[model samples]
Target: MDTYSTATLYINGKWVEADRGASFEVTDPSSGQVIGVAADAGTAETERAIAAASDAFPNWRAQNAYTRAAALLRMHELMLERSEDLALLMSLEQGKPLRAARNEIRYAADFLIWFAEEAKRIYGSTIPSSRTNQRLTVLRQPIGVVAGITPWNYPVSMITRKVAPAIAAGCSIVVKPAEQTPLCARAVFDIFDEADLPPGVVNLITTSRPSEVGDAFLRSRAIRKLTFTGSTAVGKMLASRASESMKRVSLELGGHAPFIVFDDADVEHAAKGAALAKYLNTGQACISPNRIYVQRGSIGRFVNVLTDRARRLRPGSGVDESSTIGPLIDMTAVTKMEQQVADAVGKGAQVAIGGERLREDGLDGGNFFAPTVLTGVSPAMSIYNEETFGPIAPVIAFDTEDEVVAMANDTEYGLASYVYTKDLARAVRVSEALRFGIVGINDINPTAAAAPFGGLGESGVGREGGAQGIDEYLDVKLVAHVLGDAVD
Candidate 1:
C-alpha cells in the first residue's frame, strides 16, 4: 500500500497547506513505525474550513434529493472500488486485523449505500387545518453547516457514519478527525473528490489543538449543528458549549455494555458470542462488553469455555491474517488495562487465563495485551464498575432474572446490552427492562446500517442511523396556506 505522506488539507474543494505550514506523523500502532505525514491545522484553519462549508451550504442544500442521492451513490461506488486499498490503509494506521479492516470498509460503504436511498425518502406530513380553505404542511430542510469530530478508533466507519447522513440530508460539513489517524480521513476525502463533490460541500481539517478547534466550531454562527463521537466527558463539554448558542448537538459517547447469559443458554454459543463482542478491536470499542453476568448454575461452565476461547486467540500485528487479537491504540491503553487487572486481582478476583502483557517476538516495541479472563469479579472491584477497554472479560455470578437485570442496569452508561436466553418470554422481558439504546437478544452484533444507533442517559443524546440519523442534520419547518386573505 502507498503511504499518504504529505497529505494536505481539503477545504473549499481544493487541497491547501496549513496556515502555519505544520504537519504531524501518523504512527502505525502494530509496528510502532511512522506511516505517513498529515497536515496539521489550528483554530485559524478550522475557521477557514467552517467558512468554506458555510459558503457552500446555500447551493449544496438547494439541490434536489435525487441529485444529492446520485452524488452519494457515486461516492458509495467509488468506496467499494477502493475497498482493498482502504482496508489495508485502515489496518496500517488503526492497527486492527486485516479482516476487521476490510469489514469496516464494507460497513462504511454500506452507510453511503443506505443513506443514498434514504436521501430520497425524507418525507414530511400534512396537518389538518380547522378551516376547509386553509392548508398546513410540514417541511424538512437541511440545517446548514455541521461540524463533526470523529475519533481514532474505527476511523473510516466513524467518518462515514457522520458524513454520509449529513450529505444525504443536503448539509455541508467540516470534519475534524483524530490527529492520530488523519491519513484515513484524507483517503476518504480523496474518494469524495473523485466523485466530483462540490467545493466546500465537505472539508477536512486535522489538528491536535482540539480545544481551539472546538471553540471555533462553537463560535461560528454558520455551524448550526455539532456531531461528536468520543468520551462522555468531552461529549458533555461540547454539549455545554453548543448550549450557549442553542445549536443542534448529536453525541455518541462512551458505554459500559453488559452481556448476560442465562442458565438455559447454550454455553458454547454464549462463549463464542462473548469472545466476538469483547475481543473485537481488542475491546477498545465503546459498546464492548464491559461486564458478563451468568446464572450461578452456569457460571462455572461459562468461565471455563470463555477462558479456553480467549486463550486460543493469537495476539500479534494486525497486518497478519492469522492474528485475531491486535495491539491497543497506545501504551496508555496498555497501562490502563494493567491497572484494572491489578485492581481486580487485589480485590480477590482470580485470573482465569491471561493476566499479563505480551512482550514476546517483535511485539516488545508495540502495545499488545494478552487476552484475559477474570472470575469472581464483584461490584466491589474497580473492574466491575469501570470499562476495561481491553481484551479482558470479568465474569460475575447471579441467581435469578431479577438479580441479573438489576446488576446489568446498575451503570450510568446505557449504550448497549446483550441477553442470551432460550425462553422467548424472558428475552422480551429482559430486552424491555434493559436501559440501553440497543439491545441484542441472543445476538452479539445488534448494530446495522439500517438500524438507529445511540444511547440514553449519560451515554449522550440523539440517534445516528436509520431514518433518525439524517434528522440530526435537518430542521422542521411548518408551511401554512390561507386561501382567501392574509391574516394578521
Candidate 2:
C-alpha cells in the first residue's frame, strides 16, 4: 500500500503530483483490495509530459550511440540488481506469480542489454549513384518524440519493449501505461533517474481519461511516433486518429492465434506446447492461442494431456509458493472470461476440466477463473471468432491439413500461430502458408529481443524488437552530394 502512495507521474525527469492534485487507488486483483494510490493526470499534465519529451529530444539525439549504449548498460545492471524487489512489487499489483514476475524482469532486462549493444550499430548504407561524380549515402536518423501506450497485462516487459528500442534509436518518449498497473511502470522509471537518463528523455503519466492523453499525442506534431499494445478495436481508433496528422504509428494489437496439432506429431510435446502457449499470463496474452485445432485422430489424446497439465495449476494469490495460476488483473477481466465461457457453453462447447470461477476460502472476492478446456467448440460459437483472453482452451476438431489451415487463417488477426509436427516438410509448408506475422513451429515461445515481433492485418502495424525494432523509431534519409570527378 505504501508503494502505491509513492507512485507519481514522472515528467521532465522529476516525480510529480498531478496538477489537479487528485489521485486514484491501484487495486490488488488477488485480494480485491486497494494496494496504493496513483496521481490522476488530466490533459494539462499529459501535455506537459509531451512537452518535456519534445524538449529533450534534440539533446538526447545529439549524444553518440556509444554514450547512449553505456547509459542503457547502467540501466540493465540496475534492473538485474533490484530484480527481486521489483518482481515482488509486480506480483502484488499485477497478480502474477513472483517467479513469473522475476522471469519477466529478466526478459525485460535482456531487451535493455540487447538494445544497448544495438545502439552502437545503427548502420547506414552507401549506395552507388548512376553518375560517377555523385555520391549517395543512406542514413537512418531517430524519429523524434515517440509516445508509448502500453497495456497492463505485461507491466514491465511491455514498457521495456517499447522504451528500450526507442531509447536505443535516440528517440525521446512519453509513456501512458494502463491505469490498472501504473506502479510497475513507476518502478521502472525510478531506475531511469538512477541510470542518469537526461530530463525529458523518458516521461510517464497515469490518467483515468485515456482519450485526453491520446488526443495530446495524436494532435501534437512534436510527437512523431505512437506505439501501442492492446485490443484491435482501440488500435484501429488510434491509427485513425494518428492518420489525421500522418503521425507514424506502431500498434501491437489483439490476436486469436491458432495452435494446430497434426496427427503425425508427438502428442505429449504438442500438449505441453499448447499449455505454454495458451496458459502463460493466464491466457491474457494477445498471442495466446484462442482456438486449438487438432486433427480428429489427435484431438482426444491432446485434450487428455492438456487437461492433466492444467489441473496441476492452482488459482491463488501470487504470494503462495505453489500457486502458478494467479487472479486476472481485475473483475472486468474476470467478467469478460465468464461471458466468453458462457457463450461457448451455450453454443455446445463442453468443459473438459475446470470451468467455473475459483472461489475457495482463500480465493473469495478475487478475480480467479479456473483454467478451462472446452471441446466441441465450433465456428458458430463466439469463442471461435473472438479472442477469449482468458485461461480457457477451446479445442476445435478438423479433418484435413487444407481445412485446418483455412480455419486458422479465418480470423482477422494474423498476429501469431503455432503448429506442432515432426515432418520437416509439413512444418515448412504450414509455416509458409500461415498469414500470421509470427509462426511457432514445434515451439511456443517465438518472441525474443533479437527477433522482430508484431502481426499482420488487424493485429497492428510495424514491428518491435531486433534490428527491425529500432528501424521503426528511425527515418531513412538519402544524402546526395556532388563529389570530385572520378578519374577515367
C-alpha lDDT values of all predictions: 0.90, 0.90
- Per residue, candidate 1 scores C-alpha lDDT tens digits across 1-488 of 24476646899999887886788777888878988788888888888999999989999999999899888899899999999989888887888999999999999998998999999999998999888878999999999899999998889989989999999999999999988788999999999888788899999998767788889999988899999999999999999989998899999999989999999999779988999999999998988999999999998888888988998899888888888889999999999989999999998999999888889888888889999999999999888998778889999999999999999999999999999999999999999999999999889999988899999988889998898899998899999988887564
Please write out the lDDT profile of model 2 over residues 111-206, one tens digit for every residue: 899899999999999998888788899999999999999999889989999999999999999999998888888899888879888999999998
* Candidate 2 Cα outliers beyond 4 Å, as residue runs: 484-488
Candidate 1 TM-score versus the reference: 0.98
Give the 10-residue window scoring lowest on summed lDDT in candidate 2. Answer: 1-10
Q: What is the C-alpha RMSD of each candidate to the true structure, in Å?
A: 1.2, 1.6
| TM-score per candidate, chains pooled | 0.98, 0.98
The CA lDDT at 213 in model 1 is 86
What are the per-model numbers of colliding residue pairs? 0, 0
TM-score of 2: 0.98
